[model samples]
Target chain A: MAMQERALRTRKSLIHAAAAVFAEEGYVPSSLGTISKRAGVSNGALHFHFENKRALAQAVEDEAADAVRGLVRRADRTGASALQALVDTTCGLVDSLLDDIVVRAGFQLSAERALGPEARLLRTWHEWVEQALLGAEAEGQLAPGVSPDDTAAAIVAVTVGLEVLAGVDPQWLAERRIAGFWELLLPGIATEQVLASALPEAHEGRRSEAEEA
Target chain B: MAMQERALRTRKSLIHAAAAVFAEEGYVPSSLGTISKRAGVSNGALHFHFENKRALAQAVEDEAADAVRGLVRRADRTGASALQALVDTTCGLVDSLLDDIVVRAGFQLSAERALGPEARLLRTWHEWVEQALLGAEAEGQLAPGVSPDDTAAAIVAVTVGLEVLAGVDPQWLAERRIAGFWELLLPGIATEQVLASALPEAHEGRRSEAEEA
Candidate 1:
């Protein structure tokens, strides 16, 4: 049991180190030697845990995807309206991109052309946003002229934009920037009653409460 | 005069080839040799034109920026309302991304971590959007509660998102997709009297007219 626990810790450290390198250097230029050194693990240990650079990148991507899934799941569990849950998840996502290297690296790796299309964290997030909009549509939370598909596309684009911009400057993901996005978009997509409820600021207390729990 | 024209043509060909390679392989993996061969120019000729690979990439970025600047300028010349011009410019920009390899490559290079931060096409774009929004506010085209900064951020984010997503899938920059975005945003950001005129579709004829010119 002790050995297995230590192995798990080693794997986690290796993944974290890999993400940082990949995020900073991109997937093509990053070397496993540097990753293991950064992780403070032997090259043999790194090899034992992962087959090669691709596998290590895959692991990082998987972990990041899991974090995003968990973020979306948490927002879902808040029992807020679908649009509100989406707002919360998007806000959480930008926050994660700011604070979490793994998630940031996951997104960065997905953008690498050399890495091919194996990991599609952005598409996965887009699909989730689409489903949330669909749910909102079913709940009649959407405005009369709004189509779930169109709204989802716009939301996904903005969120992806923020993610990309945040790669260069975290200010792009600042609370004010995201809140401003919602402020501009919410009124166009939600009913007047649902509008106030779905505003990004409306979920601030809920986010903290959920965080505490 | 003939020698100068030939030299200019060689430079243009080299820049185009460089943009293609950089867009496909990214800035790090892209080779000057490949770019020159693709341009059908001897590497010596390429060297005579550009100091190094970085210079070549810089030239490509410069060409792309010029195209964008021209696009924005043409939109401005249309005598459209500020918001209308902004919408038209965005739609034109997306079209250019789809049709112009240099624009695509410029954006792709801007995203590369290996290339450093000397070239910031995205920042240039964000600034342009902000200025357009400020112009809209000045023209009384913005709806109540619409702050120029916030609207500009959202517009820039969505446009950047479309550009990034289009890198993977061109469909993300499709006409319907962009039109859908303006549809969702116009109602919220443009005043009621201005909304009808600033819509993306409303500018379609104007875009072709500008294109023909």
Candidate 2:
């Protein structure tokens, strides 16, 4: 049991180190030597857990995928309008990306052709956004003229775009800019009555509480 | 003049070759050997035109900047509503990216951290959007409730987002999807009377006429 615990801890540390390197330098230029060195683990220990850079990247992507899945699950328990849940979830995601190298590297790796499209993580995120909008439209939470499909496309585009921009200028993912996106888009997607509840700022407390938790 | 023309042609070919490789392999991994081979030029010729990869990349950026500057100049000549010109320019840009590798490489290179913040092509484009929207607001062409600043932010976000998505999926930049974005957004910005003109398809003929010109 003690042996297993030590191995698991080593694996987690290696992943953290790999995510940081991949996020900054990308896949082709990243090396096992640097990753192992960064993790403060021996090269032999690194090989014991992962054989190659591809496998290491895959491990990082898998963790980020789990993080995204967790966001969707959390949204399921929100007990609010689907639209509100989506707003909260997207805002939550941007905030998470601000601090989480694993999640950010997962996205960066997915964009890389070297990974060979094995992850499909971005598409998975889009599908989740689509489902959220569909649920809102079914619940009659959407404004009369809004098309759920169109709204989903734009939302996915904006969020992904913000992620890309954040790669260079983190200011793109600021609380005000993200909240302002919802402010500009909410009036077109949600009825006036629900607009206040659906505002991104309305969910600010949720983020803070999560941070505290 | 004949020898000078040959040098200019060789220079243009090298830039094109470099852009294609950069777009495919990114900064660190791309090589002058591949670029020269792709351009069907000799190593000596490549070296004559560019001292190194960084120099070659700077040339690519210079061409892209010219393209962007041309877009701004064309906008000045549009002789139409500022909002409409903004829409047309963005859609035009998407088309340009599809056909022009230098422009495509320009954006990809700008995203690269090695390039630092020197390119700022995206910032220039965003400023242009802000100006267009500001002009529309000044002319009372903006819809009653729409704030120009917020609207410009959303538009910039969406366009940048679409560009990112297009990197992985070219289908994201299709005419129908681009048109759909305008269709969904026009109602919120342009008054009912001007709605028809703001739709992306409304400018399809305009694009083709220019293509023919």
Candidate 3:
């Protein structure tokens, strides 16, 4: 059991290291040797944990997808309204993208074909968001005329886009810009009452919390 | 003058070759040899046209920025209404992303620190859109409560988001998906007539004839 735990830890370290290297140097240039070096593991350990560079990338992507899924699940459990939960989960995911190199690289990997696990994970995440939107629509919490699928897809696209933009230019990821995004997005999907009650307060709190953290 | 024209053609070929290589192999893994070979130019000619690989990347980014700027300018001139122009220009750019390797690479390059040119171009594009939105508002084409700057930023973000999504999955780039995006987007800023006009028309002729040649 102890050995298994240590192996898992080593695997996690390798994923984190690979994500950093992928984010910085990109997938093609980042090598297994550099990833292992960053993880402080021998080549043999890396191979034991991951069969190849592609497998290592898949591991990193899986870890990120799992983390994002956990976040959405938590928000779904806690949010006051279905719409609020969807919005909160999205905002939370965007916030996570700032701090989590794994999530960031997972997203970049999803854009490329080299990482299959991340791509599946991303598709699954979208399905989750789509389910949440449908639930909200069923509850009559969504604004009239909004298609849950389209809205959910747009929300995912916007969140990823914001992360990519933020990753490239931190200045644009400022409180004002993120706030601006929500301001536009919420009006399009949220019930007016929910927008009035939930969005403004949550957005404000999120801004200060992100700044402080 | 003939020699200058020959040099210009060589430069164009180098940029085209670099774009192809970058798209296929990504930034770091793509080498100058591959680019030169693809362009059917000697290494000396590649070096003559571009100082180095990074310089070639920059040139590709610059060419893409110019193309986008040209499209925006043309849309601005041809659009019958201010809001119409904004939407037309945006959709035009998104459509262009499907085929333009330079534009595609510009987006990929925007995620890296050493590739600031793409980020700068994106920012400039955002500013131009914002200005157009403000103009639309002044022309009384926007909704009363909408903030031009915020709305413009959101629209830009959505376009970028769609492009990124399409990059990963071409299905999202389909005409139907793009139309659905506009359906969601137009309601936020457009006057009623603009919304009506923004509805996607059925295919009437060769699609590229309406925009790209």
Candidate 4:
């Protein structure tokens, strides 16, 4: 492999290892030496990719942020309505939290008081959710009595709540759970016509996969 | 004060100090020395009250649990419908989370992996919510087609999510935020007649208090 490609692979591995450690042991207790060992890289190699633990954590969060953005983009690209995209994005994000250590750790790290001001992952998710609700309102997809701002707050809470709970039990990350949230919420927030067509699929396939485990 | 009364006061102070430290620094990093110093008691006194850091954390959690039970009891005594009691209890819990250091710390500790299974505060909250929804369903207070299980899951997610978010911003714990949640949710899950009567007070009184702050 080309040196540049190998360097990139090493960098990626280091980030993943760091994320696993941070998610399990938290930011304060996680050490660079342990991360290097988990990554199967020399201490010097780890340092070459990142200057310090803080920089490494920031990189993990940035990567996770990119994943969130990608989920939103993919959801939007499906040509779904704004409300549908919001539902799809939430499901996608929860799947990422369950399957991707980096994303899980990103959220876990963001909640850590030790990380202080640099933790912006939760805020980023909240902003996107707010924007989606506003778009739905502008398109007249929302129920007449629903306030976009208030709906946004509720959606963010449910999504973040699921994320927090999933940290303790992965069942909370199931697609069906997200679908269930929309099933109850859509009737209350979507216009009659939109509610008819915008209901999220119950995600039977993915839920079965969860049950198998 | 009598000898027993003075000892009880010392124990209470020690628990409070420990909670404050644990909430700020997290479980694994919190020190018995710091808790003792913060309590304004000698290390010997702290040890006499609690055997170790783990025991001190357990005491905090137990105290917080008692407070949660108290909130439910107060709500139950209002002679409201089961659903109404659930809403009132939620509002009361959020208020307690905002004002009580011990409750806040108990929740924080419950989420920390270092504390392990002994941290049952979140589970305790989740179980109560599930029971309340089940009771609502039995009373025919729930809207047709709404599953008590699913609705309970959503409510738990929103409550836990708000509590998690409130750790970063106390505004997330505002009565208005919890009120907003119920406002959006009550319409979707309550029966027509139940919905008419069960709408959580937009909590004008509490919202104004939050606004003043």
Name the top TM-score candidate. 4
Residue B85 C-alpha lDDT in model 2 = 81
Q: Residue B112, candidate 4: how far off, in angstroms?
A: 2.1
Whole-model Cα lDDT of every candidate shown, in order: 0.81, 0.77, 0.73, 0.82
* By TM-score: ranked, best first: 4, 1, 2, 3
Total backbone clashes of candidate 3, pairs 3 or more residues apart or in separate chains: 0
lDDT (10s digit) by residue, model 2, range A1-213: 999999999999999999999888878998999999999999999999998999999899889889988987887797867887898888878887788899888877876645674437778888889999999888877766566777788887777777777877898777666676775566456655665453446434433443465
For residues A22-131, write the lDDT of model 3, one tens digit per residue: 98777878899999999999999999988998888888788888888888778867756676677667767777778889988887788665664236766877888899
Candidates 3 and 4 compared: the better one by TM-score is 4
2 or 3: which has the higher lDDT? 2
lDDT of 2: 0.77
Q: Kindly give the stretch of ten consecutive residues in candidate 4 chain B with the minimal lDDT sum.
A: B202-211
Candidate 1 lDDT:
0.81
Give TM per candidate.
Answer: 0.92, 0.88, 0.84, 0.92
Restricted to chain B, the TM-score per model reads 0.89, 0.86, 0.84, 0.90
Stretches of candidate 2 off by over 4 Å are A196-213, B143-149, B187-213
Model 3 DockQ reads 0.30
In terms of docking quality, how is candidate 4 classified?
acceptable
Tell me which of candidates 1 and 4 scores higher on lDDT: 4
Interface RMSD for candidates 1 onward, in order: 9.0, 9.9, 9.4, 8.2
Native-contact fraction for each model? 0.61, 0.35, 0.39, 0.55
